[model samples]
Target chain A: MPRWEPDAVGRLQAAAIDLFAEQGFERTTVAEIAERAGLTKRTFFNHFADKREALFGPVSERQRELVVAEIAACAGSVSPVDAVLRGLQAAADVMFEERRAAVARRREIIDANPELREREWGKRAALADAIVEALRARGVDSGTALLAAGVGVLVQQMAMRTWAEAADGRPLREHLSDALLSLHAVIGQRSV
Target chain B: MPRWEPDAVGRLQAAAIDLFAEQGFERTTVAEIAERAGLTKRTFFNHFADKREALFGPVSERQRELVVAEIAACAGSVSPVDAVLRGLQAAADVMFEERRAAVARRREIIDANPELREREWGKRAALADAIVEALRARGVDSGTALLAAGVGVLVQQMAMRTWAEAADGRPLREHLSDALLSLHAVIGQRSV
Candidate 1:
């Protein structure tokens, strides 16, 4: 057997993204990803369940866990929207701050494929549900929890888009903060 | 020749929803739905592209058109989020006011199946996109348009849940207005 690699998952993901971008997601095979990563197919299987999972798997679970935990840890004095924003910010600081290029590439791959876009939507819905559950645990009303969770997910989406398109290299957390502020501004603006 | 039915699409949808809810979506066949509706398979095909579309077809397109048209007709001085709300309200008044039971059943059917849930999410995303495009046509900036559209969708979701769960027979538009107020209250609530 070959020596163990510490970053097998990261390597496989990088290789998969590169392959999916260069060719197409449908055209790229798992074996090619493993080969490009200088790893065996068995190792790839050990890391990811399938080719699609290689693009989005454990990372989403980890992000969800981080966000939920952050929400749980937030002070009760914080407002519902602020609590959700804090949770999202905490997750973004760790998971997405340094992965701008990878995230952009992943977005492109998902945008190009309807199947991947469907899965992406599922993942997003799951994340929002998790946030809702967390908010409920904090004794928030179900209606408020759902709305705040939806807002959190929407803010994250807007922040991701702005961050991806930004020419300046700002951190994801900053984009998130800006997006939250923008949401406030948009919602607060009324016809005189 | 058989006599023509005025509500072929409605009959097919009702038949499909009943069959799907009873026997599960995968096990139910198009022919069974058509037979149950007292219509031929060709009639079902004329009404819907596939078994899945039977549950959600032209109604979604009509909802989109109503919303877009309402937004387009709103005065230029209207705020983006309010414009979206007005559009949603107009569509809800016409398309959803008397269809609470059917809407609830549809929600249950979609909730039970992951595949249907995915399609529902796609339809929702499409509606949001249409709203964004309408707002842009009115000269709203992309970011503001996106934010308003997201807020509008979020409010609609909250209103639907409330309207569905209410024991007292309240109109959907009232639930929508209440949801809008709740959103404002949630967002306005700040930590001192």
Candidate 2:
């Protein structure tokens, strides 16, 4: 066995989701989640700031960092939308490609609790801001950058919903690109 | 003085904002706001459920109902984007056209507090869901309806920020229409 498990944080998140669903998010305790995961409370704290953080903390931060970095690194030939798509594709590969079951369960937990849902909104808003900043750095104006980033995040929202519910095990990037196409179709032929 | 005040709710909102800005939301009490408004606690409770409710209670609910009803009323004779814009224009006419300064202050208070910010987001999310339902009722598919609603809400968000900060004192309806136009320009065009 490896000296350190590759997915300690993932295990903690899984355990937390199981506990939250079996009971309610409000009633489930961190101690119970730790016990279920066969990890010490110290280990849990090392991985997540608190019980709520287990569901939202690391994944959001890592995704933000990855997307912003990827956008910053895109070649000059790419359009802003394509750059955002590229960034989202990179983050999706690391955070979501093989984690469908866990992602679905986590979504259920968030949907069931108003607080969690609000936090999820906050996370997405923060990510949108990060993407906008990256675009601005790449010389996009404030207005266009804001709109493109908002559209990209909206596509992310749609793609994630489809990914969690779709029967076909298609990659999230496919849905994301499809959503961008749909956005194009809807916005149809207006001059920017 | 009129027997029935025209702006009892306005007075209450102002008092609540002052108290919250001065003492913070959690520390401020409903009774204090009522007293500051020269009304009894019963009057405050009659207008709102609690202290926090004073800031968000009526405007949010009224906006949602107005937009959804407007969309339903425009069920025919327009595309989905046009329908959503019509709904948003109706809301701007009712909720925000004359309340620019008051709206700015309310936004500031919410910005100062995490709880208020979350509730504001919750209200925005609720409004988006209501729009989606209205679109679906008009025979739009669930996916397109959701995207239309999301884009409409995004337009609302952008228009609101601009209106709140715009010194030109232009009408919110104009900004909203302008935003809808810009959204059409951005998403309507397919570069590929």
Reference-based lDDT, residue B18, model 2: 88
lDDT of 2 by residue, A1-192 (tens): 224656778788888889898898999988888788877787888888777888997889999999999999998767777888888989999889998888888888888898787777777777888999999999987777777788878889888888889999899999888887876665452222
Q: Encode model 2's per-residue lDDT on B76-190: one tens digit a residue.
A: 7677777888888898998889889888887788878877766766777778889999988999888888788888878888898788999998889888878777765655434
**B16 in model 2: Cα distance from truth in Å?**
2.3
The superposed Cα distance between candidate 2 and the true structure at residue A151, in angstroms, equals 1.0
> How displaced is residue A33 in candidate 2, in Å?
1.7
lDDT of 1 by residue, B135-158 (tens): 999999999999998888888888
Docking class of 1: medium
Per-model TM-score versus the true fold? 0.90, 0.86
How big a share of the true inter-chain contacts is recovered in candidate 1? 0.57
lDDT, model 2, position B118: 65
By summed lDDT, the worst window of 10 consecutive residues in model 2 chain B runs over B183-192
List DockQ for all candidates. Answer: 0.56, 0.28
